[model samples]
Target chain A: MTEASVRRVESLGASELLALYEQMCLIRRTEQAAHDLFMSGMVKGTTHLAAGHEAIAVGASAALRPDDYVFATYRGHHHAIARGATPEECLAELMSKATGLCRGKGGSMHLTKASTGMLGSYAIVGSHLPMATGAAWSARLRKTEQVAVAFFGDGATNIGAFHEALNLAAVWRLPVLFVCENNFYMEYTPIAEVTAVPNPAADRAAAHGLPGIVIDGNDVAEVHDTVARAAAQARSGDGPTVIEARTYRHFGHSRTDPAKYRPADEVERWMARDPLSVARQRLESLGVSADELQQADAHAAGVVEAAVDAAKNAPEADPAEAFTDVWADGGSTWRT
Target chain B: MADVITYRDAVADGIAREMRRDPSVVCIGEDIGAAGGVFKTTVGLLDEFGPERVRDTPISEQAIVGAAMGAAMTGVRPIAEIMFSDFLACCWDYLANEIPKVRYMTGGQVTVPLVIRTANGGGLGFGAQHSQAVENWAFAVPGLKIAAPSTPADVVGLMAAAVRSDDPVVFFEHKGLFASKGEPAPPDHVLEFGQAGIVREGTDVTVVALASTVATALAAADRLAEKDISAEVIDLRCLIPLDVRTVLTSLERTSRLVVVEENPYQGGWGGTLVSIVADEGFDLLDAPVKRIAGACVPLPFADALEDRVIPTADAIVDQIRTLVAY
Candidate 1:
């Protein structure tokens, strides 16, 4: 979106840039379809959509290796997809299908595919920061070069777990990337009004002895470039980085919210720089044709369509399923 | 025949043996390393295992537990200490919600093989916040294996079992029984999760207890013998994989039961033990089952007041007298 970030976008290959755009499109389509399904009463629980805050997850995910771990929040459709979770599994999970991720037990807020290293999407605010840090510690202890990434919102910075996690990670010099997708609002209220500092995440990074790096989250290239360098730094045994991405959410916090608390101008401002539009512009400026961009968008649309159709056809989560997977042995027995 | 080994020493022995056997096992707490834990349960760990495996973290319960969970998820057997069981409330989200639910929520994609060892029960005169037997908090949550050993051998053996368990275990090491002595645990002794040891078998009445209460119940049984009351004392080693069959079988022989728990009466493990007997072995009961537990209030600070609040040997004997008389 910026002339400076376009320079960063130039680092990515033409095809890699195309893939990032397509990935963002897939997340967008999946969320939009999920929203429709939720309104139609097909989705059982409240769904958190990451429409405007796509590049932060997608760009950051693209920068990491497959073996690296990602700890995401409830608004993590984009992060999950970016970390190799199929749109079908995520949508199927949202619809509570048996074929869904976690077999519909996690519903919307807890979509997890451990095989992909996308550890469960934690619903509690600021809960996963330390978890991701711990995961990084595991990698260090186990002698693996893998890094762990935690995607959270600005609201998490105010919570005690956030500070505790940052302090622990800093002291341990753990290989973790604390990516704060500052969507400007903590559910209904503006984060700035409640938070003490100006930059909630980056401003507090010095206290934890981590480098405070802020980025334009609307620019996928900037997010990818910054995260790539940070991940490399972590992999090389350099400490964790606190990355604050300035972004906004396109929709309400959850299924019921209208997000009328936000100013109309602010919403319009964020909408004007939507991640999808920004990605398209960056692609076109990089000598990509309009027809080529449309094809990628069309492919994304097709993926979402197939995913939604498959999810709808999948059987409902069985009553018996409710009593399964409580233990690692695949049984719900608490007592013998 | 063994020398008197303190219950506190067995805890460290258990962890040290596990750490020796498995390199993946790491211990983390506020003052575990250098300070050797506030209760000295983790003594000699940092010296034996070195600082890499034996770590001391900041006074952040959330950080300690969450980090342990994270490590556990990724093939590390972490033994995290929360100083006091009452402090479990500070990081309860991880214990009650996140840690237990990980395996279930992830559809077994992740296995949380970690142990949370905390100082439990209310006899050290540490007052309400520092001295509550808070295993009841973890008992309500599924996916966690709860272990509260009574003796020195049981402590080492149960600690081995907890560290080695694939399922997350909340091992409640009673603060009150730290100085209490018992037989030394044999080398590499790993206790099973659910086998409730019948420490003292009697046919007149069966009294079930765990942690510090097991000792109190044993003392009560000693006093009850003079009254011609044969009290069978069962030390429930693990609470989650509750050995209900053992409790029910004892009830069948005795035909009367009394659950002695150090946690308050409100949501203690006593309610669960009693319900199992009522539902499955109601015919085994000659009298209404009695629950001799801590009074339903904050554990008072004063020595005498605290004694009144928590079930003492006399209180347990009195409750059984009432149960046996009926």
Candidate 2:
């Protein structure tokens, strides 16, 4: 927490601050709408909502270029939307329609749009960290100044792949930014209970010879400033940085869990500093009028409503697609 | 012209051939850089391709495979070595759950065009942990393309095809066959998948094998020929794009099938061959289909005990005699 750099909010232009606030509003609206769709029985299975973690995706992605790659976890709607995947397609993927991000093949958990540099949203925990390293290495080999970002939860830091990926990235001096969204809980259990260290990601960054960074994930300006500096270091070939964003998940782990484990006061305390509220206050202090903030919320709501309609109108994916895309030849046949 | 070379040298030649042809081709593994790999299969790769193209990795199988998968998705063709075939279990998640399923999950947005080559099977008393033949482990995964070459020539040929394929390929090179000599594959050699080579053609029994068992089956055929029992040996070059047509055709004339494999009996890859034959060519069988597989037990350390567990040339000969008698 002490090590990460954060500048005052006055440095960001009024237009840029408004854009970041709009992005966070967009994610908040999208995940909430997804929650409604699931409760209405329109979206099946389960959804991992990112209600309070909006600023991390929005602020972090704002610092990355379009060519830079992002590997996010299953609860990655915010990351996908931030990286330019249309809300219509991401919602379509949730509704299992033909027009989805993964064309309905990867429902709820997996959402991939390589065209947008949203490499994928992997459901399996702690798996894609090394993948990000590989992409960064490839960028270096091609002489491109591209960097790769991997977004995971606090639980992933304890996994073997996490250590291996960090060590390899450090040893190779790869342009990788490992962002761990530490929301205090890994599913139902408190991450603090299972984790050996107090700060899972930042505390161990020194072992890999990387900077130990912890930031106020709810503050959009702080997140933006820290990630931008980390990205700059990476692009300049100074190697990776580990950032732990201390936030809280407003919703339960999934659609099924009610998350009754938290004390009422603890929940209330975190909700008081909700990312949307924090960003709104930041906008107000930066001279954004109250009317403009209302207009941003209105814009977010309108886009989500239109996206829902467009996705609902799209037909179900064809059964033939199930057999296709299993191989490069567009066929699953492995034998004669 | 390097007229004759061992199977291990051919492995290096295959990777070098591809690396020379495509700049995107890169090789990485433990001790593969300057030490030339534990089995010396990757010797001369580092000196020839430089440290960038032929790089060494830490003892992290997941990172090696995962990095290769990511590199492939981002346009670099990578070839990762697992050192031993049994060590694939360490990174089974990347191979079974990640690399193979990427294209399908992303709806063809990515192509994991990578090769994972490892030293496979037992003959030199490496014992249980290092000696187990686990190609069957990868064979069960649907999206992977499996290749187990029995000779130096097939090594070069299959390595070319695996590196060029748009899908992920798991290549198994026999540790026992490293020293076996054969004519070197030409520089331009590129064999396709699904084409099984007829090592020795005959008219009695169809003996089908892959990698280590291919040599054992060939030796059995020679002994069977002495006893007036002609055996046709079919070398299945690639497992995923399996040439069952070749096996069915061979069985068409022979009317009897015997599957020889180094994997254990309970869930070996031979079961797939037997099932397909029973389903498609059941009427072509004159006797019950026989499976000469490695004993369902850990490979022992002693030479005699190890010989009992792994399928040997004499074991293949004895089995073929019993099947011929039936």
Q: Deviation in angstroms for A86 in model 2? A: 1.3
Every candidate's fraction of true contacts kept comes to: 0.74, 0.71
Q: For residues A250-300, could you state the per-residue lDDT of candidate 1 as single tens digits?
A: 889999688999989988988999988998888888899999999998999
TM-score of chain B of 1: 0.98
Supply candidate 1's per-residue lDDT for B53.
89
Runs of candidate 1 exceeding 4 Å displacement:
A1-9
Per-model CA lDDT versus the true structure: 0.89, 0.90
lDDT of 2 by residue, A1-336 (tens): 454354444456778989989888888999989999999998988899999999999999888898999999999888999999888988999998999988888877888889888899888788999999999988988788999999999989989999999999999999999999999998988998998888899988999888878888898887888889899999999999999998999899999688999889989999999998998888888799999999998999999999999999999988899999877899998776
- Candidate 2 lDDT for residue B286: 95
Give per-residue lDDT, candidate 1, residue B46. 89
Per-candidate DockQ values are: 0.80, 0.80
- Which DockQ value does candidate 1 get? 0.80
Highest TM-score among the candidates is held by which one?
2
